[model samples]
Target: MRYTLRQIEYFIATAETGSITLASERVNISQPSISTAIAHLEQELDTQLFVRRHAQGLTLTPAGKALLVEAKRLVEHAQQLYEVASEANDKIRGQLTLGCMVTLAPMIMPELSHAFTSAFPSTKVMQVVGDHDTLLQKLASAEIDVAITYDLHVPEGFDFVPLASLPPHVLVGEIHPFARLSAVTVKDIASEPLLLLDLPISREYFLAIFMQEGLTPHIAARSPHQDILRTMVANGYGYTLANVRPRSDTAMDGRKVVRVRLAGDHRPMVIGLVSPKERRKSRLIELFENHCRNRISDAYIPGMVAPVMEKRIRLD
Candidate 1:
């Protein structure tokens, strides 16, 4: 059973997009070529990878799901070989699939992408944005070279390198009562309508702060969009608890918002890089990791205003 790297690439592309046509467009190959590669791959492995549905698209079979894990790893290793060869010649050149938390993507990706690309023009960085779970899944599945996200729940097989510690802060409309206060308590914010940034692990972390204070927030509005939550807070709909703050002090509608320190030992969000614990680190991944470690700091990020802490603190 000799399966070529090209076959694996076609399989992965089809599995991800769930359509040969889309996969063709993604890999810049013809539909027939992709279909033939998949067919040959299935025969070589003696397993039907995709179930074709009329008018809809392809769905991975259980066997397909299992094979995808290994296929991605193999393809990634092949790419890394190219990176290794380039590095051996004292050049940094290869492809990198970078995954970032959805909320962080809009604010950080542009700047990080620009810096990394400009520094290493030969390196190709592909960005994949998703929630924590999706990013973790991609990391585990070898779909992405590395992930930039909050150290929410980095499971057993991943290594997290902390970049910056972001302590929780309360955001309120400029006209809101809490805006006038220097610092606010969780209980105080909980008493008012709370606009939650409801994304998987992140949602739990925010709510847990209230739980620790023995208060149940008056749930008003919830959204997966950070901007929507901010806009809601700015519009006086409710107050939001967030670790990260935008550089701009205003919302999309031009209404101003205020960031008040959460008075107490609020758990800081550790923004970091996550990669597979056991995978051989490629030169490109190492270079990119170094770029992040050097650039991302406690007091500086491209689009976020560093939280004003009374003392330099990093909460474990």
Candidate 2:
């Protein structure tokens, strides 16, 4: 063979740590060994994977970026193959790559991860977080086994299993005029300045609330991070809308925010698991899928105080 998995491992380590010295430390290999492996890999591939800087570490070239994702998947799959071959029982034991929407990760990943890993102690879970489009893209590209996200803009070639439904609600600072209200309509929300979440599918979902009511938002501020948006709302910049509810009423900055339900018939977004429709499912994937369905009840989700509602959607 022109290259070995060891070389790929070394390449990945260097790319991740962004320095040969750190990669050596991370993998418990010598610095020269890491460098040699990288050189061999570059030669075999006939391309420069990284650009080395004098004391600034290494940065991935376009080629490196393209290979990193596939390399990680290959390495993990190889590890899973070994685990499966060596197993003497039916217990789940393998590497499982999971992707989650950025906003949902903090609210649900910890509990879901803990439950799944505890149920299958021999398994290793690799978690990736990004916006809806990014997670969906990874799932479509076979970069992740499954994804947890809202049922927004899901392409036709994917399977979705609804776990929970999160309804849209207005978020306001404690001192905002709407904070004390039990609920407000979309028209009320449209009348005020809006702080948009500004994520891929999520942004459209939020704006759709106003669209359904035949109104438009007066966007005052925007951010991709939910915490930053919450913090902005907490500081009274403007009100925002959201689906998932953290158990706490305070933002990351320790400022208080309130969730006021939309008074009218506002359609809620569906939170669920997504995977490619035609792909073969591993036993580990099936087990984790069932585990998610069984465990993601209202009582299980962290940072959620609202009653978990079941709104099923047939993806077939």
Candidate 3:
């Protein structure tokens, strides 16, 4: 071969970090060595890999971007070689890539991922957060091995393993008119100004609450951030709907909010694991999937709280 895996490794690090200096720091190598490997790669491939700016970081050319996915896969496959040897001793040791929904990441990822790694010290998890559509796209493109997400717009070729049921709840300020209520129906809040959680499938699910009741939500504002929406609700900008509420009802800005059950019947979001149906499950993937099963359920989620309800969807 004209090039070495060391060259590919340096190439991927620089491409991801966007600078030879940062890539060297990440890989614990000298910046000059990193630069030399990438330069040699460019020579061997006869392509300009990155557009280098004097002060600014490097940006991948189209060719570099196209090859990045393959480079990452190659690294993952290389890691799998260790797993093969590890299997002789019945050890689960390899890296697993997880793509999580942005909103869910803060609520669940830290405890879930950390605990899994803690359980298997030799194993590691790398997470990338995005919206519903983005996570699904990454799953399709082989960028992520598994997705910890809500069941939303899941395409035909993906498998969703339901983990927990998050029923809808309403957020209101401590002084808001709805705070004293035990529960409120869709029609009761349908006319109230809504601070919508504006995300791809999330918004659709929230709006569907009103739609199923044959009413229109009076949307006053929209935000992609959950905390922002909570803060807005705390300050009485408007009420918002959510499935996951942090254990504490206080916003980051030190404002208190209340989570009131969205009363009566409506569709709730099911949080679960998603993966390509056709893909063969790797051992690391299996370990992570099993970890999720133990850590996430209607009875408990790692770092988030759900409203108490009599009925819940159980994993069978």
Q: Which candidate is the best by lDDT?
A: 1
- Residue-pair clashes per prediction, in order, are 0, 1, 0
TM-score to true structure, per model: 0.83, 0.81, 0.86
- The residue pairs that clash in candidate 2, if any, are 247-303
Candidate 2 lDDT over 93-200, as tens digits, reads 877889988988987888888878887788878788889888888787676899988887788999989887777888999999898887788877787889999998
lDDT of 1 by residue, 26-97 (tens): 778999999999999888888899899977899999999999888877876788688768968988887888
**Candidates arranged by TM-score, highest first:** 3, 1, 2
Q: In model 1, what is the error at residue 300, expressed in angstroms?
A: 1.3
**lDDT-best of 1 and 3:** 1
Arrange candidates by lDDT, descending.
1, 3, 2
What C-alpha lDDT values do all the predictions have?
A: 0.87, 0.83, 0.86
- lDDT score, candidate 1: 0.87
> lDDT per residue, candidate 3, 1-316, as tens digits?
7888888888987987798987887567999999899889889889998998988889999999988988888887797797787787888787788989888899799999999999899987877889999999889877689999998678899999999888888899999999998789998998899999999989999888888888999999999988899989999898999888577779989999998778788777899999999998887898899989998888788777643322342111
The deviation in Å at residue 48 for candidate 2 is 5.0
lDDT of 2: 0.83
